[model samples]
Target: MNSGILPAAVAGFSTGLSLIVAIGAQNAFVLRQGARRHAVLAVVGICAASDAVLIALGVAGLGAVVTAWPAALTVVGLAGGAFLTCYGVLAARRALRPAAAAGLTTQGTSAGSVRTAVLTCLALTWLNPHVYLDTVLLLGSVAADRGSLRWAFGLGAMLASLTWFTGLGYGARLLGGVLARPAAWRVLDSLVAATMLAMGIMLLARTF
Candidate 1:
């Protein structure tokens, strides 16, 4: 094992972790699902898998292809923005209609099925142009700079993503008690709504 590989992997992990730890739409969904103990494993698995593919693609030089076809991201941005906005609207409705939320939350689970969660997770991940811009373009470009160690960096980044999503999805359960309360649920959903709507709007606005 070349000593340089270790440092490159560590750097990759730090960079990947930093990129994803934010309270974006994807993380919010993961948090909400985890806190509720609803299909958490599936959600985390999807997120980690999606990121691995993207990061791998980036390292494999798909970044060049993406750069050549910038319009592709525009298409994705529009779809992602609309989906986020609609989901945000639904979250806001749940927050506003506590009575309705109570019925949904009383069962200690959201109305979403595993399929729905999976689809939403996919949409949140794949449709968002930022994922490509950051992971594919930025991370890929950075990894390329490593020359022979680009794959090592990509592996480190992939590991970081897996560890982070797994930790985030499982760790949020620590707050399950607080989030179980109606008041807390309202607050969480409200934040989710705000985050989703704002990100959605930004994506849409930027696309134009």
Candidate 2:
């Protein structure tokens, strides 16, 4: 609300949304989970909270630690790539089966258990190297330039994360009826498969 911090916060919000709007492994997973109406709140919470924590760390200058230890990101990339590949395969298989795909969207319990969903969300959030690059290095640097308003910038960025995820997770329900059809599921799953596979391959390539 302070006039001094307003511009920094606006800049932070714009930058944060620009980075987070990209199509990536985490976004794809969130879309699918949202469409399925599976642990939507938990999934959204984990994503937003994770982003907040990472952004806070960045504002606190932890990006230096990350820069010093690049190997940690490599390890995460390998694990994330493997998980994505596996998820892609499952999506592909689901797409091939009309019956399985048809039932997935309509049933509240069709998706994995809440704990499993939460774990998957966490993995997607933490394991992706790009998250660190974007949130820690890029956003951190931007926030640093804000000087006295760094926390304000970080808060604005964090607000963007929360707003985006809440909209995405809840907005997806609008497609519930449409996704209930087998053809719709097939299309969605196929897209998911392709997105996951491409992202996984890219991550793996970076690791090697």
Candidate 3:
């Protein structure tokens, strides 16, 4: 019995990690907050906890209900796409201004405020349609057939979320020195802008 459960748990861990390791809005926000060393704990906690809740719901069979209501994901996709496009534009604007990027890296700004950080983290997590597809529909669908070991699969997935968020939020500082430079900041922001823009376009395009 334990042997059968172990494979499912491992599969859950790998799947959960794979789904989240991509460069997405939530990750970009978390990395920025982590690099800024501002409200890192709050950002990481929110991300991990949100993932855990989503995974649990998925494992508990919420995925079927969500899949039944495609309209819900459409709404989320529309909102999330708009938000990502706006954020991408802001990032692009910042990248164009070397001084602004440099200042943001050094002096910081109101965007780093705890309230703003937490709110942004929440929005990034909850508003994204992909999160629903991956966490609820995909993971839930897979876990539903795990028989008695379904919860074990969920527990493993939840652990993966916690580990990934903790590492990302805390480990971001390793690149602090590189991002401190204006040129490097430009590169980072440019990548972030492109990523956000592409993702937003993809989401919006899919809806049409």
Q: Who wins the lDDT comparison?
A: 1
Better-scoring candidate (lDDT), 2 or 3: 2
Superior candidate under lDDT, 1 versus 2: 1
TM-score, one value per model: 0.95, 0.95, 0.93
**Model 3 misplacement above 4 A:** 1-3, 108-112
Q: TM-score winner between 2 and 3, please give it.
A: 2
Residue-by-residue lDDT tens digits, candidate 1, 144-192: 9999999899999999999999998999889966776678888888999
Q: Can you list the residue pairs that collide in candidate 1?
A: none
State each model's CA lDDT, in order.
0.89, 0.88, 0.87
Deviation in Å, model 1, residue 154 alpha carbon: 0.8
Evaluation by TM-score, superior candidate among 1 and 3? 1
The residue ranges of model 1 lying beyond 4 angstroms of the native Cα positions read: 104-112
Compose the digit string of candidate 3's lDDT tens values, residues 1-208.
6888788888789889988998888888788778777789999999999999999999998988888999989999998888888889998998899988888655544555778889878888888898888998899988888988898899889989999999999998899888878988788788889988998888899877
Looking at model 2, the pairs that clash are: none
Cα RMSD to the true fold for all candidates: 1.8, 1.6, 1.8
Question: Model 2, 1-208: lDDT tens per residue?
Answer: 6797888888888888898987777887888899998899999999999999999999998889888988998999999999888988998999999999877755655345777889989988998888999999889999999998999999999999999989888898899888868999899889889988898888999899
Candidate order (lDDT): 1, 2, 3
Lowest lDDT sum, 10 consecutive residues, model 1, at 102-111
